[model samples]
Target: MTSPILLTGGTGTLGRHVVPLLRDAGCEVRVLSRRAHQPVEGVQYATGDLLKGEGIESAVDGAEVVLHLAGDAKNDEVTTRNLVRVASQAGVRHVVYISVIAADRVPLGYFRAKLGAERAVSESGVPWTTLRAAQFHDLVLTVLGKMTKLPVVPAPGAVRLQPVDSREVAARLVELTLDKPAGLVPDLAGPKVYSMPDLVRSYLRVRGQRKPLVPVPMPGKVGRVYRAGGNLTLEGADLGERTWEDFLAERVR
Candidate 1:
């Protein structure tokens, strides 16, 4: 029989996909959350808050592996440290962390937080693995949704994105959980690289919107990084199966 697994952020986009995978694999799954949630088949929920370090001990108790998926890009450092402390005390064996691509190099605040969280996991004195992935397609849609509301669409001409499906990322995380603790795995990206204009046009196409595409530069160090492809993983773009356009067409249309 396999050991029980403790998951943080089990209700998140990626976590929701992962829980069923684990359950189908016949592994007992325990979820840690901040609020009460109705029961679901093949899963158990424990109330906990990572920020204030409340209810974490019970969440980590007797769990051989801790799959950490929940994090606030703004304050994940504290949350991650709290998790590490509790999980370590509970004698958890392996900790899996999900992070963004180029988190160590990016100048963005959230990226910085991810890097700090990665360090927390690595330095926690427990066997751990970290998987850094490109932006999820859901996030891309959120950005596009905001742009569609504007009278005119401002498109970033210089930036490119390879948005992977969150489901694919979840699969990779599950695979990593079963493998021996490798420090950090290769970055994962979508099947194709798309410029900001290409993605926006596709959004407009699928949504049947004819909003004028205004070629605009995103102003800031973050924008400059994006324009320079700092957020992209060129070699990793071949990792996932789904493309941004297909994702939009299937989900958004």
Candidate 2:
């Protein structure tokens, strides 16, 4: 019998899409979660906390491939380090990591943590592949939804985002998880880029609401990076088919 594949972040936005695909591909899956869950057919739950370094050894045991999708705004490096250490000890064959576009270039705590996690995976002694993707449509929608609640939306000047569908990203990650390890694959981004105001306008249009948009200039090094498109993959990147408009059409309403 083939060993089961280990999956982290198995209950997250991306993981929800990945689990069914992996199951349909005829692979048994073990999902690591902080909370307990009843096992389903071909899928088992391993209770673990990557940040606290608890239950990882048992989670990784006997798994050949690990798809690490769990992450947070902070401490991703520490969590990934903990997972890789156990994965190495377990003699896991491959470690697949999903990161954000321009993780190294973006000057933020979250981006820095992601970059650190990438380093941990690469140096883990296990064969590895990392794919950087743009912000998910779900995340973008949440941000815009909050902004729309305000009387006047604050649009960060010169800030742009290419929001890709989480399902598309999940599909690509499943393919990578099933294939041989390939290091640092080309980035994946949404087909179209939209400015902050454009995104806000689109959201308003979808919701049939009108509100004034206040242009707010982003300042300092972080602002400079965003203005220069440090958070973007403009060239040599795999583009997802779903547009932000397509996502809004389906989700908002």
Candidate 3:
């Protein structure tokens, strides 16, 4: 029997999509999460905390491939380092990591953490594959939802975003996890890029609401980086088919 593939962040938005796909491909999956879950066919749950470095050895033991999808707004570097150390010690064959596009270019703490996580994966002395993807449609929607709640929505000036569908990213990740380790594959982004105001306008139109949009200038190095499109990958990147309009049409009432 083939060994089960260990998956971190199996309970997250991306991991939720990946687990079913891996199972459909005739692969046993072990999901390492912080919480316990009810039993499911062809899927096993391993309760562990990557940040606290607990129960990782048992989670990684006997797993040939480790699909690490777990991440957060902070502490991703520390969590990834913990996972890499255990996976390395377990002799895991392949370690697949999902990162954000321009993780190294963006001058933010979150981006720095992501880049640090990437380094941890690459320097783990194990075969690894990393794929950087643009912001997810779900995340964009969440941010827009919160911003639009305010009386006047604040749109960052000269900032644009390419929000890809999570399903498409999940499919690509599963393919990489199944294949050999190909270090730093092409970036994945949405088909179209939308300025901050345009994105806000679309959200307002979808919800049949109107609000004043104030253009807020992003300041300092982060602003300059965003204005220069540091968070984007225009060429030599794989684009997803779904657009923000398509996502809003389906998700919004």
Candidate 4:
């Protein structure tokens, strides 16, 4: 059997795609879930909880690679530190983590936790690779949905973003697992940049909702950062064919 790969968050939006890709690559995949479920053809489910540090050692015992992708934003730092400690003890050869782009750069609560997690992964004794990617298309879609339902469609002033498809991100993740650890790879972003109002309009056009867009400035330092393109990777690498429009067209209608 090939070296075992243990994936956390294997049932998530991106993980769902990665599990199959790894299996197709002839890897023995073990996923850490909270409860037991019928196993897939070549996959094993290990019961574990990062928050409580339960079942982690057993999960990491024999796996050569550990893909750390599970964690709630609120407590990601705790999860990451715990996972790293166990993976180091387990002698895992390679640890790969998925992170959002500018996790350290962004001051959002979740981003701060992600930055801490990244720090943990970097300091883990095991070899590791961290891929920081742009926000997922589904997230942008959610924002659009919320904006359209508001009393007025107010857009963040000059706020720009580059959203990538989660599946494409998953494919890159699988590719990284196959190669030697390269530390931090280039930031992954969408092919194009988009303004908030434009994205909302694109979403509205697809949904057949006609609404007037009221452009407004986002308050606070976070807003200022976004307005200045803090959340964007205009010069980063990209690996997604499905645009925000493409995702909406396919999924919304």
Candidate 5:
């Protein structure tokens, strides 16, 4: 029988979906979080952090595989190194990491961090699979929360994104966790790519807020990549079923 599966970032967006699927598959699930929490039916929670490497060994102990999903998008490289060190020491077999698409292309800090994290995981000497996917529709919501106040929204004009559903991405991660570690996989993306201005407008319309959109050209090489469709997969590899519109309409509630 497979040992319990250890999932980092279990309280975050992707892990919220992944935990249930693991349970549905009859795999024992353990989650590492910094806060104390009550246990779910088939899940256990342990307090931890990716920065300081706290509560890591106890989290991975007795687990057959580690879904190393914990990391700040800003400092993912450091987090990945810490987790890899701990998981390597714990003698865990397989590790499945959720990374962003085109991490190597964009010159943004966060994307660079993700690329650094991927390198750390790959060099950890542990059996590992790193899967990169397009941004999630929820990312738009996050952007809105950060950029918009009430009636005004400032964002990039030509930014193109292929946003996938978090649940579907989580499903793919669960599949990777159970399979043999296959190294870096092809990009997973939404059925269609949409511009940022259009997507944000659609979101605002749905939320009953038709805020005036100020399309400012984001300043940097990363902004250039955003304008050049760096976030999209040209070969149309592993297209997930949800469109940006479909995601906003159905899942945003």
Candidate 6:
């Protein structure tokens, strides 16, 4: 029998793609889920909870690689610290963590928590790789849906973003697991950059909504940071193939 590869967040947006990628690579995949379900072909589900540390040790046991993709958006720092401790104690050979690009540059509490999580992963004695990626197109889609309902999109002024496909990000994570652990690889971005208003307008056009776009400055220091391109990648690295337009087209129609 082959030792399994433990994947946290196996049922999440990226997890849906990563499971198939690992399977195609001929690696036995074990996913940590809150509840056990009918296992998919070439995939096993183990009951685990990020908050309670339930079923983590058993899931990590005898696994060659542990992909730590499960972190709470509300409490990312605490959840990450807990996961790191468990991974270290389990003697996992390789720990791969997914982080947000420009986490340090953004003063948003969410980004701060992610940065704290990255620090935890780096400090852990186990070999680890942290892959930072830009905001996903799906996330942007959600934002567009919400903002379109309002009379104005409340577009942050001059905020630059490079949204990547979640699948591409997941594929990179799977590739990283196959190779030796490299610490803090260059950030991944989408094929192009778009401003907040531009994205909103594009979304509106695609949806055939004629809502007047009242572009307004985002409030607070975090909004200022976002306007300063807090979410963009300045360093060139891995660029995904999918564009926001591509995602928007499929969803709009």
**lDDT of candidate 1 over 56-152, digit per residue (tens):** 9988888899999997968899999999998888888899999999997779789999999999999999999999999899999999999889999
For model 4, where is the 10-residue window of minimal lDDT?
232-241
Q: Candidate 1: global Cα-lDDT? A: 0.89
Q: For residue 202, give model 2's deviation from the true position in Å.
A: 0.4
lDDT of 3 by residue, 128-187 (tens): 999999999999999999999999999997899999999999999999999999999999
Clashing residue pair totals per candidate (backbone < 3 A): 0, 0, 0, 0, 0, 0
Off by over 4 Å in 1: 236-238
Better of 1 and 6 by lDDT: 1
TM-score of each: 0.96, 0.99, 0.99, 0.96, 0.92, 0.95
Output the better candidate (2/3) by lDDT: 2
RMSD of each: 1.4, 0.7, 0.8, 1.4, 1.8, 1.5
Q: On lDDT, who's better, 4 or 6?
A: 4
Work out how many backbone clashes candidate 6 has: 0
Per-residue CA lDDT of candidate 2, range 1-253, in tens?
2999999999999999999999999999999999999999999999989999999999999999999999977899999999999999999999999999999998889999999999999999999999999999999999999989999999997899999999999999999999999999999999999999999999999999999999999899999999999899999999999999999999989
Shift of residue 180 alpha carbon in model 6, Å: 0.6
> How do the residues 142-246 of candidate 4 rate in per-residue lDDT, one tens digit apiece?
878887997689987578888999889999999998888889999888877888888988888998889988989777888878877888777757656778878
Which residue ranges in model 5 land beyond 4 Å of their true spot?
Answer: 145-150, 251-253
Model 1 lDDT, residue 182, Cα: 97
lDDT of 1 at 114: 97
What is the TM-score (0 to 1) of candidate 5? Answer: 0.92
**Of 3 and 5, the candidate ranking higher by lDDT:** 3
lDDT, residue 41, candidate 6 = 81
User: Which residue pairs clash within candidate 4?
Assistant: none
Each model's lDDT: 0.89, 0.96, 0.95, 0.87, 0.84, 0.85
Question: Best to worst by lDDT, what's the order?
Answer: 2, 3, 1, 4, 6, 5
